[model samples]
Target chain A: MSPQDNQSTSVAASTTPTASESASARKVSRTEVRGRVWKQLPLLLGLVVLWGVLWGQFSWLNILTGFLVAIAVTRVLYLPPADISGRLNLWYSLVFIAHFIADVTVASFTVAFQALNPRPIPTSSVIAVQLRTRSDFVMTLDAIAMSLVPGSIVVEVDRERAILYFHTFDTTTAAAVEAMRAKVLVVEARIVRAIGSKDDLARIYETEATR
Target chain B: MILDSILDILTGVFLLLGGFLSVAAGVGLIRFPDAIARLHATTKPQILGLAFILLAIALQERQVSTILLLIFLLIFQMITAPVSAHMIARAGYRGGIIAPRSLLVDELEQAIDAAPEFDDTERASE
Candidate 1:
């Protein structure tokens, strides 16, 4: 089935609405169907590459099989249709990747050092930060990035208020809480620049200016 | 032959560091005072350590097929580690496993105070 058809089906399945009702609500053309599939091509390719790696083979036959398996699994899994902004700032993405690598390296060392230290363990805190972007894509990315960074992990997301709750290490004071909050916003801003739509980026800048 | 030996040595070093980090994460899990702090031990170094081990395996193995598997392992670990941690932390919070003294700011609690559905639980906690 075309990706547009897949999207309609997934959307219908996601909400309480009936399949026929959703199908009739929106008319999707053949070109639009192709476009939607093209949009999901990255996810497909990533899955196929992952499958190939998992099989530990890079041969054309293995890759072809992986590609086919990727398609089948994704189709059967019933994932929500990807909602990527489609706009990418190459420079910002490169910077973001570099920053992420550095953060991971540094944060891991810091956490490891503290964990192994004989001194009293610094108190941890659960802090809430309001996010500017409302996109689930950005929010998920932000949470994933933060969680992997060693010092903090996302505990909850209040989707309606665009507020994210994080459990952070060594956040004993109000200043420390604010610092962690600022750090999260900085990371969010980088993600916004790297992949968010123009409106999202503009909102980030506006939020930053106001703060 | 010399270059191959050098690659093997580097891979071994990476594998050692990965093992050490994994051990450190275990230590943190035991040493941490609360559920959330323990989650840091379970998530961060564990995933990074696995990545290192996967990288070492990928480097030493010449088979394209096996390398693909190693890469997949690394990616999947990275993706799932955070998600699993998130689930556990949320469950811990909702279950009241969070040490009230450790929480610096309780915005969720404040929100729950205003929420009618949470009124009884909020009062009970107080």
Candidate 2:
């Protein structure tokens, strides 16, 4: 674990920072810059709301102070802001949430039962799935959601290619592996439908049409 | 009066379910064959178990702030859990700690094998 972790960090340290630096270095028009900052507004507001929630109060004074604090933190502890797709389909979001909850519940029990079963230990696999959307945000959300649902854990991410390699547990057959890969695509599609950019939506639809 | 008992019963059921899942998680850690398998064992059931427990807490307290805090905690857990799991799995895979015999297929290994190695000069630039 130690050697591998060191290698992982070395690889991560080498590859990731350069990409981020290049992104920040890229030239953008004034409106694009403004839009980027505008995209951060929700995050700032969410921070303010989180502060109020933490204090268990929403007083005007609290809100004002929270706003100031949010400003301070965002500046002092800077992180790249997410470019959220402004289009959020409420119906699809609800459906995604519903399906996610169901997956978590069902998968948890299945793993539990498998763990306690007397049968021979099932074999697992590491499979990579190419994502339709190149959006980092959607990829991350999909990874997080997939990880929590059980049976799959994200092992490595190829950011440039929009590929996620997942370690799938207790899948013994090629068919099962294929099934899991298909399931990952379905999950990604649901996420894209909910809040993906127009480009992402078109990419997903194009693939679906071709399929 | 009846509603109170029903809520109490619901709380008990959720708590019991959470406890069962936690126990299963513990059993899985010991029972699974390899590192990745153990990772799945611990992550999946523990999250659902924690969710159940949080649900029980929300049911019992029935306060706006408490529920809010509970949601925050769960969200924090959900966000962090996968990150740590990914880190561990990535390291373990790189470390060669996971036994190759245990896996039915290892697509990542093939990809890793096929990719060209980075030279020291390239790494030194960063």
lDDT of 1 by residue, B67-119 (tens): 66776676778787887888788779878898978777776677666776644
Clashing residue pairs found in predicted model 2: A4-B95
Off by over 4 Å in 1: A1-27, A54-68, B62-65, B117-126
lDDT of 1 by residue, A1-211 (tens): 3323222211122223346755653688889768778887998888877766666556899888988888898677645465688899999999998998789878887887788987887887777888999676787788889988998987767655678888889887889889999999999999999999888999999987887
Candidate by candidate, in order, the iRMS in Å equals 7.3, 4.0
Per-candidate DockQ values are 0.46, 0.59
Q: Mind giving the per-residue lDDT tens digits that candidate 2 earns over A60-134?
A: 999999999998997776665665888899999999999999999999999998888888779989999999997
Please report how far candidate 2 places residue A117 from its true position, in Å.
1.3
**lDDT (C-alpha) at residue A207 in model 1:** 84
Which candidate comes out best when scored by DockQ?
2
Q: Candidate 2: where are CA atoms >4 Å away?
A: A1-33, B118-126
